[model samples]
Target: MLSRTIIRSPGRTFSTSTAMLNRCIIYTQNGDPAQVIRAITYPKLPSPPPNTVNLKFLLSPINPADVNTIEGVYPSKPSPTSNIAASGLGSQDKPVFVGGNEGLAQVVEVGEGVKGLKKDDWVVMDRPQLGTWSTSRNVPFHGVIKLPATGLTEAHGATMTVNPTTAYNMLDGFVKLQEGDWVIQNGANSAVGQLVIQIAKNRGLSTINFVRSRDDMGPLVDHLKSLGATKILTYDDLNDKSLRGKIKEWTGGKDIRLALNCVGGEPTTAISKLLGQDAHLVSYGAMSKKPLSLPTSLHIFKNLTSHGFWQTNWSKTHSRTQKEELIAKLADMMKENKIRAPEHTIVNISAQESDEEATAKIRDVFAKLAEGKFGKKVLLKLEDTAT
Candidate 1:
């Protein structure tokens, strides 16, 4: 069972207070990873707009995009808000802005005009701008998706926003794949890739997954296969021409209709070469940080389609109803054991913690991630009571 706790502001220890308090992580100037994040405490919350709900965050996953935002490369920028109340020495001014894009929250209070949600409802919002890294948020009710209560833990709910949604949208959006249709993707062991394999299996699609050689490839391959991957290959196999023949045989010589590339460069080119004519290749990330180069023959003769996908763009253009439908489907799949949450390591950024401690912890994690040493997703568990 998962441990649960209510977080309150440190000031609560000094006196009996009724005001809602929130603690947030912010970055003002972007440069090195260490200089970016600072922990700020707020004494009170701003009055919610009409038809809005105030939410207490339960969990927020720290994603690569969050790191990119701190480095000032990401497109979305946090805007200043006066909603945060005064804290101690820096209490008079609102904090720069809290830093997370995706999280799972519970509605603790609703504005008078808000209708669809009430206290104690599980919800998620696209308040990436307001920041999900904080202990609480005030967002329009329409922006929130109410999740089913039973069998879902706060960690699963919090981590649901990015990876799972990205996986679902990528698989469902680009192709018209049918049962037994073969799809190929790199980064098979990644959180998104794992979800893709599970979703594909649920839809009866076949998958050809690729991963880098690692000490735990056995466990990773077993995990993907358990999720219904048809075959698993490593980057080393892409260099061997014979593997292409093996892929062809496994795919029954049927054209691989979709190729999902998270790692670019030669690996991407290899996947492109394997695609049958009129196949689609979608690039959602560049983990390798190398530019993708494709030969002219594949483009000219194969009639292949190459697309770049950003989940942020998809979220903006898609309707709430459509997004909710996808979430509902995923939740049902979880209930039926068709999908499972990705493995993750949790870092609790409790409101009462010291800034140095939080900063040091985050910095170390970022370093590990940059070094490719961290294997699972890192999540920040926020607390909200008086905090």
Candidate 2:
């Protein structure tokens, strides 16, 4: 608790009578992160602006896109800055960008004019490019999005925005799919792919899932099937020349109208060959680090449209109310236990760690992520999020 409670509601600022230090993953230059990323601390925060709030980090995910953005390859990049807030960040010789794009945080202090959020209330960085890999931040009221703290665990709330919403929109936004309509997706065990299986199951849509062959492939396949995948196939199955004919016989000439491809290269090409006429092939990722190759025949004769989907872009174009409705819908399913959290590895970033230790931990995690080790989502859970 603060020594004195400063309640400034509409046209006032909170007095800087209290001190809060913020620790963040900061990158002043984009390159090999092993050489650049650092941990910086903000000694104290001044009074919040009339339209802003102070938030302490709860849990932030380490996503592939976040890594790429740090490497300076991703399209949606966070702003490099030395002056995003008065949190003592500008002392650096050069401007820097924080790591993380998605995470859950809790409000600790609010500007008098801030509405809908209060001390101890949970919030997620609903909007894009807001650097989230930090212990705390002073964010504009409009830039922060709040979620109920009880329904979602740190993992659920931290991750709820991007992948689930992406899968939800791709399924419901592009096509008018009926109960029996079929959808096929590569990377079936990916965070988004798993969500697709559950959401599709809930909507009565049949899902055909494909994953890379692994030693534990059978168990993975079973797990997905339990999540409601109608069928699971491996990349090897896609290569089987008899696959299309087999699908034709099994599906009884059913139209597989949509395909989600995160693994590109041959896998994308092979899946495109199975779509019905005028099907939509949405590419959201290229885990294989290869370009998408669609058969000319599939496009020319079947009239398939190859497209891209970015959840960030979608958020920009749609209304916040619409996004809230979708979040509420997802929440209902979560409350019903229809949405299960994915397996993940948590790295604790507390207020006590030194810069070297934090940097080493970050490098270690990134190495694993780069090597694709530990088939689980990596999350940095903060130990100082309490209001």
- Candidate closest to the true structure, highest lDDT: 2
RMSD after CA superposition, every candidate: 5.1, 4.8
lDDT of 1 by residue, 1-387 (tens): 223444443221111224545677776567656566776666556657789987777788888888888888898776665565544333335335567888888776788888878777778775456588887778888878898866676667877778888988888898888888998999888888998999999999898899999877778777778888889988888889698789888888899989998999888998889899898999999999999998888879988889999888898898888888988887788767788876788888655566667677777777788888877888887554343
| Model 1 poorest 10 in a row by lDDT | 8-17
The list of candidate 2 runs beyond 4 A from truth reads 1-20, 83-93, 384-387
What digit string (tens of lDDT, one per residue) describes model 2 on residues 1-387? 635455453322232334445678888778977667777665555667899987777789988788888899988978765644434555555576878899887787899888888887778776677778887777887887777546566678788888888999999987889987889999999999999999999999888898988887778877998899998998889878898887777667988889998889998898888899889999999989899877788878898998899998999898878888888888678767788877888899765676678778888778777777868998886543223
**Predicted structure 1: clash tally:** 2
